[model samples]
Target: MSTQFLDMRISSDSVQDTPQRELTSSSLFPYTFGDIGLQTASVSPSNVNSVRVTLNAYVRLLMAPSSNPTIIPNATFTVRRNGTTIFTTVYQKPANQLDITYEMAAITVVDFPPENEVLLGQIQYTISVSTNYGIGLGARSFSGIAVAGGI
Candidate 1:
């Protein structure tokens, strides 16, 4: 994608730091409830290339201690722009450790709105996480931040 990311910001101290959010296993689907966050800024649609979009997030997921820590958890992260899906990925949380942290990063590209109009308004950035298995219905935490800047 030719779209660029501008003004990246991390929710944690820095892009290198991984933030963790707790995840409780779901009885309904084995996956924990979605942990969602949002970041926004205004932009000038006329300057699509120059238009700044905040992105580049680093996520760290910590699995709760359990008797069976080897089950492994399936994790999914999604990023959306203007209510449109721009990026998505799935991975398995690492297993076996006193305190295990699974880290992942995402870099997003700006998608021009339909009809290429000069949009002078607020823009939306979204981050969400979904996980299943790990520790078998056990509680865990996933931490991450949006690293803002232009690609």
Candidate 2:
């Protein structure tokens, strides 16, 4: 089997000292923190068969009794491709934990079967976080690569 690289795209952002933004919501609503747009090369369905996407994020989870004694801090992270969800993760900390930093990473591969027609065009990937109490995002990175191979 042989494979060829078709296209690649990456987006990254970070804050120096403080978090980029402190997200807090009484309702469960996702806040988009990072996004990237990738233009895939037009190729024959027989030549391209898969796309790989990777995402990384640095976040601070804070749970303070003084701030919100009634509720425990929890956050849900989601990854979407063109508004469609592909992956999701959740982080929760006890009130006693106070503050913690986490480095999260996720990867996914989209494959097109031989019988199905391949769709290649503008693609967008986004990372979002939803919280109940409070959460902070320090950095985030998203990347994707399209490859051609026999499927």
Candidate 3:
């Protein structure tokens, strides 16, 4: 039941809505989506008018270093939306040691990597340090940085 999250990253989303209904009275539900509360669905007044729909997903997470990396089975891992775990994931720390490579393609983000990448909007991790590594108990602890963005 142990969980791990690596290469964690936060993403954002935005949805637009219009204040107009496109339905006819002939239809049982004059509202656009009936009772789904869609853009065309009446909000102010049930029979007054139509409306637009808008939704956005906000994402945010923390990425810290595990004080005891040498003793841990893996450096870092990733957290899944469906509550799953992935192994051998790499986490970039706050330093010049991080590596970056770019290729022109259909994808617009690093999360699209085929070999060691993950889907959008997922991030979390855990680890165990050797009893002798780091500054003792303090060595196995690292700070997590918060990263978030979207296109």
Candidate 4:
């Protein structure tokens, strides 16, 4: 079966030398770093059955030492759709490391069957980050895209 592309949407925040945002909570909470909104055309489930989402970001994580030197530093990146979690990625600093930075990408495909396909209208995508042992985020560029397609 040939696939049909129904819609596509993109959003981004590109800021050079952006100020660092401190994250102190070890728990995984909604700390929004980026967001995007996509409006999908109303279609029958037989016509479109899935949405492909891609997220990219440049992140800098600076680990601050805690009172106990042995505690490891870690950070988590999460992707949510309409207030529901769709994907999550975790970064753990190597033992004795003080800081790290990198560009990360996450992708996921959401499937809908004909009987229960309910994803329609306006959709919201959110990106959140959290760290343990205190960490700073700086000079970042975050982007996301949503593509609705069917086979």
Candidate 5:
């Protein structure tokens, strides 16, 4: 049995097991805070496969807690294969998505590929983040996933 990411669902259905090994800060693409900022969290086949791509954009608004805040995080997700972008999702800040006075609702996962019924059971997917206007993922960028055939 091959590994998959039990968390990344293609719809209200699939999950993956190859989580921990799939994505990592070093394996991802290092896009600046303005360009196509993205990083490869994890991918199937332990390499770039043409099967499929799934991405989740995680954002944490870091306000200095002072009267003046300058650094704003750009929350978004995208994927690329061999240097070509196959998917991209932009998460905009809510109307008051900046005010650090109160706690607000966080953004959710933005799925793509139209969610077709006849999907590819086994596909190689990669992840990346938008850094054009926000800070990138640092130390806490590690996750877990079980591989197929018991490793």
Candidate 6:
């Protein structure tokens, strides 16, 4: 068995600041972080017996409590495989906290059968963030890897 690496990162400069009574959630474009939006990794159909996928997320935030010191943003991370939702998690933050960094991870395993395989098919993964209050994510990153083993 061997492993393949998948790296992704994304950043947005459009900062959103809303009050506790007027907060909204948004999704960043799905793609590799440093490169364009989509990234693909190969999956071996015939020789592989099972596939394992893992994800890691890092986020940077800029809190402006000085503007509305009573509100905090609730953040969540969602990961999708092949345009299908696979994992979701929420990031916890203290109400009075200022600038901070957040991190998370997810993992899953699946059987790889040659009968269901598509030629040159690739495994695609996406990471997105959702927030419920006033806060800005200055930068965000996601790294994923897949390991396939033969029977």
What lDDT, from 0 to 1, does candidate 4 have?
0.59
Please report, as a residue range, the 10-residue window in candidate 6 with the lowest summed lDDT.
13-22
Stronger candidate by lDDT (4 vs 6) = 4
lDDT of 3 by residue, 49-138 (tens): 111111211111122334444332111223221223322233233343222211111111121121111222222222211111111111
44: Cα error in model 2, Å: 3.7
> What residue pairs are clashing in model 6?
9-33, 31-37
What's the CA error at residue 1 for candidate 6, in Å?
Answer: 6.3
**Compared with the true structure, what per-residue lDDT tens digits does model 5 show for residues 1-151?**
3544433332111122222112222435544211222222343444233222234333333321222245343344655433445666654443345553221212232223222211333333344454434332322121212122223
Worst 10 residues of 4 by lDDT: 109-118
RMSD to the true structure for each prediction, in A, is 7.4, 3.8, 23.2, 3.7, 12.3, 7.2
lDDT of 4 by residue, 1-151 (tens): 3354444554444354456677786556646777766555554455455655455656566666555667776778887777777778787766765445433334343423222323555567677778776777765555555455543
Task: Flag clash pairs in model 2.
Answer: none
Model 1 lDDT at residue 10: 36
Q: How many steric clashes does model 6 contain?
A: 2
Superior candidate under TM-score, 3 versus 5? 5
Question: Model 2: how large is the Cα RMSD against the reference?
Answer: 3.8
What lDDT score goes with residue 115 in model 6? 24
Q: What is candidate 2's lDDT per residue for 1-151, written digit by digit as tens?
A: 4565656776665544255566776645677766766555565456645543334555444433336567776778887777778778777665576555453434454533221323546567777778776566655555666556643
- Compared with the true structure, the alpha-carbon lDDT of candidate 5 equals 0.33
C-alpha local distance difference test of each model: 0.44, 0.59, 0.21, 0.59, 0.33, 0.46
Candidate 6: residue 120 lDDT (0-100): 33
Provide the TM-score for each candidate, comma-separated.
0.48, 0.70, 0.17, 0.70, 0.32, 0.54
Candidate 6 lDDT over 12-41, as tens digits, reads 323232212222444444233321122223
Error of 6 at 90 (Å): 0.8
| Residue-level lDDT for 63 in candidate 2 | 38
